[model samples]
Structure formats: structure tokens, C-alpha cells
Target: MDLLILGIVVLIYFLLTGYVGYVAWRRTETSEDYMVADRKAHPYIMAMSYGATFISTAAIVGFGGMAGVFGMGILWLVFLNILVGIFIAFVFFGKRTRKMGHNMSALTFPEFIGRRFRSRFLQYFGGAIIFLGMPLYASVVLIGAARFLETTVKIDFGIAFILIALIVAVYVVMGGIKGVMYTDALQGTIMFLGMIFLVVSTYYILGGVVEAHQALTGISNLIPAEAKAVGATGWTSMPVYGSPYWWTLLSTIILGVGVGVLAQPQLIVRFMTVKSNRELNRGVLIGALFIFVMTWSAYVVGALSNVYFFRKAGMIAVEAAGGNADKTIPVFINSAMPEWFSYIFMLTLLSAAMSTLSSQFHVQGTSIGRDVYETIMRRKGDRSVLITRVGIIIAILIAVVLGYILPGSIIAQGTALFFGICAASFLSVYAAALFWKRATREGAIAGMVSGALVSLFWLLFEYKKTAMALGVTRVIFGGPVISSMPWPVVDPILVGVPVSALMLVVVSLMTEPPSREHLDKCFNGIKGV
Candidate 1:
């Protein structure tokens, strides 16, 4: 009987989402509309869409579970999400991105960067990176949400993953950016309400926020010896500074995603969805508030779940979830919340996963079609959209295959890896393209290639996750690390981003400056009077 009711609710939600996608498809006449919604999105819609895409199943399920193991120190990411991701991104980067995108008459992010520097190679390279790298991240999102469905709904993980991907692909292929943002607005609202209830309910169950935190603090001595050796202090405190655990949290998890948000092609394209600076400004408060409620609540609830599990089951969240941090939040919700709320929150997790996956699929498709096929191969008109739709289908299949094969514990790490690579490869050049008049085509190419290759090399040889996964360290180095130093523990971003930025500056200084007409066109309406 309860399953029937839940089915009805899910059906209604899907019907509404489908209707929105249909409307968007009907409205999408030109390729521009398919790519950027004709650049006329409202402030609220744009803000909600951005928030939805940013806070994915990775944040709620993967990172939330991380909070269960690592504790409240993860809240630093919330600060960065607001300060850097929202404030700096929307105000500083977004304003310039919108003006520059308009000035260049570019539809895709790669196209914008390529046109700014007049480099076809740069454009094709960026598109190829997106095509090759994004599926791993998309797979993580799939696994996170599928794990939740398996836990709460009694569904098989593979079936849930494929079903979710297929449904999202249908809307994305048919509706494009318009369909994506419209559904994102709705999903974002559901996510906000669900997370708000989760936080409040968790506090109520634990007697209050103060009491819950106190209980967590009192359990410091319960830290596993293995965890403590690596720098875990307690669920309520930061890891020991400069410890391997601390490096993993700060450098890999927090810094990777925090700074990496700037270079996300899907998020950057949001700036071009609106017409004027006013829309961007109007979106700042909404985006900030949405991000805060969504992120803060998840972390708080995740950390508090340790208290709840210890009291009820005499086990910590990770132990209770069978040693998988990715399972902690799902286990906690099923055990802590009422049966009905579990079903409702399942929808919340679904919203998180689907919203993010849709955006990723859309971006991947456009990267192949608009950035590669149209811009690089010279395809045009309606055929471009057709190629994009085909690309969306192919991207979905790749993500599903990856989701099926990846280890269950890799959700959070996978998300961080993709974010780190994106930041290392793109952020430096992107900043230069928007703000530096001296940024030449040669300089941009050098920075991008060097940054991307360094990140890849570090991941293969030094970063433990990929190195160990690939057996490079064990097979080649005959050790856990290739270096005697703690390079294995540090994220590639810390090294790659700096090298990339330095290369951008040094190469630009050495190369000839861009033409006067090019600089004027790129900086028009953005430069100071």
C-alpha cells in the first residue's frame, strides 16, 4: 500500500518533468535556444538551475557520507561554495563571461574560449577533454543516487541507474538547455525543502543541535586506531593539521571541488543563459542561500548521524553502512527517518542526481556537437542539434557502463578527481581569456596542454586513487607511492594549477600580444572606463 502511494507521487513528478521538457522542446526553434535558452532566462530560474546542477548526488550522498567519517570540518567547503563558487563566480567571473560570450557571439563554453583567442585547436582540445573526462564524474553521480535507491526502495542498483539515465537522456536530447533548466528549477525546490526537513528532523531526534554536537564531541576517544594514525581526531573536530588525513580533506576534497567549480563548463555556461548583468546580480542572493541550506544541512545531518547510530546501534555510521562511506547517508536515512519521509527524501536524492546528470549530459553533447562538430568540423544548422542529440545518447551509455564497473567506495573520490582535473586544465586559461588583454593564442594553448598533461601524469603516477587503481605504483614503483615524499596524499590541483598559471603568465609575456581589434572586442562592455 505504501509502495503504491510512493509510485503515484513519483509518477506525478515524472509527468510534470516531461511536460516541462515538452514545452521547452516546442519553444526551441533555433540552435541558440537549444544551447543557451536564447539568453533570456529569469533570475530565479537561472539561480535555481545553477544550484541544482552544482549540488548533485555527489554532494548529498558522497560528500555527506564523507562528513559522517571526517566530521564537521567538511563545513569549510560550504564557506568556499558560497564565497568562491557563488559570490566570486557570479559577481566577478559571471559578469565578464556573459559580456564576453555575447561579444564573441559564442554559444558553447569551448567556443567562447576558442573565439576569444582565435584558436581552433584550443576549441577542439577543450571539447575533447569534456567528452573524455566527464563520464567518470557522471558515473559517480549515477552510483550515488542508485545506491540510495537500492537502500530505500529495494531496487537493484543496475536497474535504478539505467532507468535514471534513460529518463534524463530523453528530456535532455529532446529539450536541450531549456528543458534542463526548467526541470532543474523544480528539482532544486524539492531538494531545498527535503534537506531543510532532514536537518530539522535530525536535530529534533537528537534533542537539539547543541546536544547532538556535544554527543559527537564526547566520542573522540572512540576514533578507530587506524583512523587516528592518519589524523582523524574526532567527528566534531578537524583532522590533525598536516597529517595525511588532513591533506586528503583540505587539498583533495575541499580545495579540489571548491576551486574547481570555477572551471566547470556547465556552470560557466549559466552566465550566458541570461541577458544582462542585472539577472546575474539578482541571482547571487538566491544562489548563495540555496547553496547554504543544501550544503550546510547535509553536512550537519551527516555528522550528527554518527551520534544517532552510536546511541541506537552501538556502531558508527561507516561501520553501520558496512564500511562504505557512500552508504552512510542512505543507511542513516533509512534507519533514522520515518518510513514515509524516507520515500520523500528518496525523491530528493533523485532530484540531486537527475538534475546534475542532465546538465552533464547536455554539456557533453554540446561539446561534441557545437564545439567539435559545428565549430571544428564545420557542420551547421539543424544537423548540429541532431549530432548533439546523438552525442547525448552516447554520453549516457558511457556513464552507465562506468557506473556499473566502478568500485562502490569511489563516489566521492571520483567527483573530486574530475573537479581537480577541470580546475587544473581550464581555470587559468579561462581567467586569462576573460581578464587578460595580453593572453595570446599560443599562451592559452601552452597553459591548457601543460596543465592538463601535468594533472594526468600526477594522477597516473602520484595520486594514490588512480595510481593504486591502475596498479602503477605497485607494479612499476613496487611501493604505495612513486615518490618518497607525501605527494601521493596531496591532490594534483595543488601542483597542476600553479604550474598551469605560471605557464600562462610566462608564455603570454614571451609571446606577441593579441591584435588591438581582438582585445577591444573581447573586453568591450567588461573593461573599466
Candidate 2:
């Protein structure tokens, strides 16, 4: 790689991104504009921004590498991402969220829920959860970007981490959601084009799509003994039923991320950014296609890299990257792709990373500042925006520090962990707040608290992977997990969401329903919707 050429290309990309941020910053005149883009974003910008923020470096680098290790079975997540994340989300959740948010004059997700239920407690609790849990997700995204730069550009990981964090933090602190979404549109375009080129070039390099699939399918014997023990089948097949691999893939990766996306603070807020259902309807096809190309291409190219690695080095993708699935895609690209293509792909990863990170930082900021601080202080104005800027900087610092501290091959695990927690803690209450007019504030509180507790308990005592990582169970119970086999492997979302939903429904029916006037206000303009 030519240092001067790389520098010039990166400089141009930064300048373009900075220009977009500057425009957004200039247009932002109030907290509403900063927090929700003034609720009048274009369909194209909303769709692309949502998709870009949804599919981050976590998808391409983290989960893409997991596809290399787990095989094409991980492709199921792509299907669910389109169906649940985009289709159901836009059609069911997005439209209602938009109307209700507007009705409540809510600028943030927590604020939406809070105002809907007439509970300041809900607002602050929700905001506190996002402020605390989001850093883990943000940190993994930072790691994915830093890892790519270190692998492809030979930049020091520390330097790359600081540069990426600083760039995203600056724009997010200044431009707010407007800045975040504008740059997301630009970054999303780069990611889409790059992934198209990646998948096409990968197939061309390996003979053809069919040949590549066949080549990958023929290497079942290459599965390591340990993997086979855990029910590894092949790159083309799903893991065997009841096996640890099966449990982790189905419950953790596929279901956790797929279902969890619906309640994501950063993503849910995108629905509030648009003005009406018309924009969301127009955005459906665009968001779905963007997610399909970005995710499908990553998984396909990731799985096929096995064939390339096996043929060239007599090793599978994971082995080629020395047992670190997180490095699989990076190693494959740098070693197999043309020199010029590597530069283009580098920007693709950077776009994916920055777009998502900006959203994360912005949401985290709003959670602590707009939701928590304003609710507590009983105030909202310029101070909310200023406090949000300070919160963004703090979020960036925590994420950068975690990016350095976390262990290797943690990209996918960390992503799944955070997504699962979000789904468990917020999904049930969020859904009820949107769709269930009979739901009481007490019920919502019960659901939220129960869901969060169950999720925290599962992470520390039942889910073996996270339990072992945190060492809470090990220290307290003298083992990594309290339960046996399947319970240890099962995801927190499975148990927590159900418990939460059950509590909400049962408690709501037993308690006094919300006032008719409040329900009328929330459902006003959402009757047919």
C-alpha cells in the first residue's frame, strides 16, 4: 500500500464527510433539530441512515467473521434482519412510533415511552439502561473499525481507535441526529457499493457462485474435532439440533440480534426522525435492499473465504486467521483481494463503523442528557443540547477505553450480548407502549423492571458464555454457570422477553386501564395505521 495514496484518499473521504456534517450542523437551530432532525427527514435519507446504523462493522466484520466460523447458517440472520428488522419494524412499529412520538412531542426513544405512559421514572430508567448498556455495543463497533485499520493499513490499533472515535465524536456532538443521519446516508452509499464489488469479485476470484458454494460444501472434513464435538456440520449446513453450537447460533446470534433490533434505542429513534408513514412506506424497499446487500454480501463473502483459504494455504478461514474469527474477513481481504480494492474496502469498513458509532454516540448522549437530565431537572431547552454534547464525549471515552480492554475474537459475542440485553430489557415495554392502548403505566414499569432483572440474572448466572466472561458466577457459585447444558447456552432474550411480556399483560389486565383521553391522544392519527 502506498502511504501517500492512502493518506490522500482518506483525506478526501474525511473532507466529504465533514462537509455533510457541517451542513447538518448549520441547519440545526433547536434541540428538536439536533435530536430528531426536526422530524422532517427525507425518505431516502431516513431509510439509508436507518440501514447504515443498523448494519455496522459488527455485521460486516464481527458477524461476517462469525459466518466464516459458523458457515452459511448465519445467513438466517440476514433473512430475519430484512423481515423483522425492516418489514415488521417499518410497517408495524415505525408508523405507530412516528405518530405517537409526534403526538407526545417526544424527541428521544425514552422520552417517547416516558411521555406516552406519563411516567418520568420510565424516561429516566430507560435512559439509564441505554446510557449503561450501549457502551458495550459501541465499544465492539470501535474494535471492529480499529481491527480493520490495523490489519489492512498497518496503522497502530491505538492510533486508529483514537482517530475513529475523535472523528465520530466531533460530528455527533456538533450536528446531533441531523449530522449523524446526513453522514449516515453518505456512508451507507459507500458501504453498499463496496459490498456489491466485494461479493462479485469474491465469486469471480473463486470461479463462480455455484463453484464457490460447492467448494465450501466439500470441506466438511476440515471441521476441527472440538467444533465437531459441539455439532459443527459444514459451511453449507446448520448445526445439529440440541448441540451447543445449535443453541448459540439459533438463540444467541440469529434470534438475539434479529429480534433485539426492534427495540434498539438508536434505531427506534430513526422512526421518529421522519414526518409521516408515507416516508416510512417509501423507505421500506430501500431499507430492506440496503440491509440485504450489506449483510448478505458479508456472509456470502465470509463463507466463501473458507474455500479460498483452504485452496491457498491448506487451512480454513478461522485457521488462516489463527483461530480468531474476528480477523477472518480482514485477513481474507488483505491477502486475497487486489491492492486497489483493499483501499476501497477499507473505506467501506470505516463507513460502516463511523455511521453506526455516530448513531450510538448520539443516542447515548440523548439518553443521558435529554431523557435523564431533563426529566430530573424538569427542564428542556438549549441546556439539553449542550448536556448532550458533553454526554457524547463521555460516551466516546468509555467506548474507546473498552475497545482497548476487551479480549480478541469478542466482536460477535459483545454485539450479541448487548443486543440480547436490549431486547430483554426494553422490547416488551416498548412494544406495549406502541400498540397496547389498554396497557397501564404500572404494567409497563413492572415489565421493564422484570425484564431488566431477568436479563441481568441470566447474564451473570445462566448464560455460560457471558457468565464465564464476567466471572460473576464463577466467583459466587464456584462455577461458570448455575444451570446445566442448554440453559447455559440459551439466550437471555428467550426468557426475559417472555417474562416481561407476561408481566405486562397480566398486570395491565389486573390494574386500572389508562385514561381514555390519553389513549385518544396517542391513537389520534393512528386509527387506520
Q: Which prediction has the highest lDDT against the true structure?
A: 2
Runs with alpha carbons beyond 4 Å of true place in candidate 2:
none
Q: Provide C-alpha RMSD values for all models, in order.
A: 1.0, 0.8
Candidate 1: lDDT of 524? 87
Residues 23-114 of candidate 2 have per-residue lDDT tens digits of 99999999999999999999999999999999999999999899998999999999999999999999999999999999989999999989
Clashing pairs in model 1, backbone N/Cα/C closer than 3 A = none
Looking at model 1, residue 395 earns an lDDT score of 95
**What global local distance difference test value does model 2 have?**
0.93
The whole-model lDDT of each prediction reads 0.92, 0.93
| 1-529: candidate 1 lDDT, tens digit per residue | 2889889889988998899889989999999999999999999999999999999999999999999989999999999999999999999999999999998988889999999999998888999899889999999999999999999888998899999998999999999999999999999999999999999999999999789999999988878899999899998889989888999999988999988999999899999999999999999999999999999998898888889999998988888999999999999999989998987898899999989999999999999998888876776788989999999999999999998789867888999899999999999999999878888898999999999999999998898878888887688868766884568899999998999999989998999999998888888877572
- True lDDT of residue 178, candidate 2: 95
Residue pair clashes in candidate 2: none
